[model samples]
Target: MNDSFKKIAKTIKKSNSIALFTHISPDMDALGSSMSLYYAIKSLGKKVSIFVKDNITETQATLVDTNVFEKDCNQSEYDLFISTDTPSQKRLGDYAKIFIAGQRKIVLDHHLNDDLKGDLNFVDTSYSSCSEISYQVIKELKVKITPQIASYVFMGLSSDTNAFTNSNTNASSFKTAYELTLADADITNINELLYKTHTTKEIDLKKFLYNNYHLENGICFCLVTCNDLKKLNATKADCDFFSSELINMQGANFAFSIIESTPSFYEISLRSKHGYNVRDVAEKFGGGGHICAAGAKLKYESIEKLKDTLVDTIKYSGE
Candidate 1:
């Protein structure tokens, strides 16, 4: 409906080949939105490729036809490079070069990060999910969104909003929800795959992570070492559902999950209620996201040191 949306539609219309991508360890929203856009682009009889850091999980493998690449293909052979749901170009993982080195790039995202580098960027943190933005793009393009496309968009929105439970859910989100319903997107099917489909390893890892959570000063924290991941045979995607749940604790104003991806380093995921400023907390540690949810990485002598620093950083007035 706006000038930028119309420009994006025209860009997509003219491009013959487009490659869609997301950050590493693609979450449901990232994967869902990327695949949804892939389908919409491919429907126009253009060549489209969907790239991620790794192969799709059994849960999401069925959501799209990902045969464009065999194994993390790095060749940049597309006319248009489109990235979705990612904050930084570096977050593009193996395909970061394709985004940075490519001539034409379009970034559609919802995360609150200032590192957006692209020829045409549609970055809005106000939207609940990148999928919500994707829906608007397709609508502006007047593209025929198939049932499967709508379903993937629904999954992306539902996952990022925590089933519409997060604070970002707004009137636009609900209006998109209504449009998806009109498009005959199976809400039941989407919910079943999202909520009901979980591996035993993921479930066990979540339980272990929750049990290990340490609550102090209105901040809920947990540390999952690499060994913990090996024990659960879980990948980063497996542990994603842990951070938001910790914030669900009735009394806790904030929650943090520090995952030890390697020795002497940890990836910290932060979440908080409406009043707490999580972006400020994440920025202190050189990470960023939304006010309610954000993340940072810390290199420490030990995990204990990381915990101590984070605990001190979170202990502020009006918390």
Candidate 2:
């Protein structure tokens, strides 16, 4: 349970400079909630900075400002570091070193099996998205949610819940959305860019996944290697919805998508529902998330080897 709000608030109140961070290859929930907290904290007259090693993917550019994150962080300038939506230091990617170097750290996450033992922590898996937890943090800080801040929280909530259609969605998700709307959240931008719109490249990737998905033993899975992406002129970001789409298969109990981020490095996203547990599979690969959704990134020597390892691991895990 998240039982340390007073301690977290006290830490923030004492710190003069702050640095904000999130997981590598941040999804909407990761960036949105972190940046919202950045703005809220800055409003309190504290110097705040955001440090991220990766660029915002093309699909994410629709909702996030690319300029909002910096490639480098000077650790000496910040008195405290805050991480959002990230479950572990390994998930921090290149930023893990800087995060480890921080004298004081705070983690606010909703993912299960967390390993980031911050000086201050607030982790609650009961929430559908980290944004909901962030909303509570803002409230505890007594900061009013402005339109911009509400937009971030709302985007994080909507994206993480897949427009409130995922199994994780609960009454609190809608209630938070309602309150954000009253705060003038930019629903139009979120609805249009995140849900309504798609690029030609994304559509092409969708067609590719549709044609290539494998169904065996109630599991439907698909993957795109560097060669596949090169042939399609698509990037990994365009494959964001592949797992979500595969989960729609009528007979499948589990769906997964593996996208090669670079060379032999792969990024995998898993989805499931109706009592199935994909998080268990992800943890086997040193990653974790909600019961119905999870992810992992790994590097392999070859596509064939990667496929073999994944198949064997999933089989061993009884996935």
Give the number of the best model, judged by TM-score: 2
The local distance difference test score of model 1 is: 0.79
Consecutive 10-residue window with the lowest summed lDDT within model 2: 310-319
Instruction: Give the CA lDDT, 0 to 100, for residue 181 in model 2.
Output: 98
User: What's the distance in Å from true for residue 105, model 2?
Assistant: 1.1
lDDT of 1 by residue, 39-141 (tens): 7887888888777656456666656555654345445567888888889865776678757777788889988756757788788888999998888888776
Give me the runs in candidate 1 sitting further than 4 Å from their true place.
1-3, 55-58, 62-76, 317-319
lDDT of each: 0.79, 0.84
Q: Give the TM-score of candidate 2.
A: 0.94
User: What global local distance difference test value does model 2 have?
Assistant: 0.84
Q: Which candidate leads in lDDT?
A: 2
RMSD value for candidate 1: 2.4
What does the lDDT read for residue 142 in candidate 2? 77
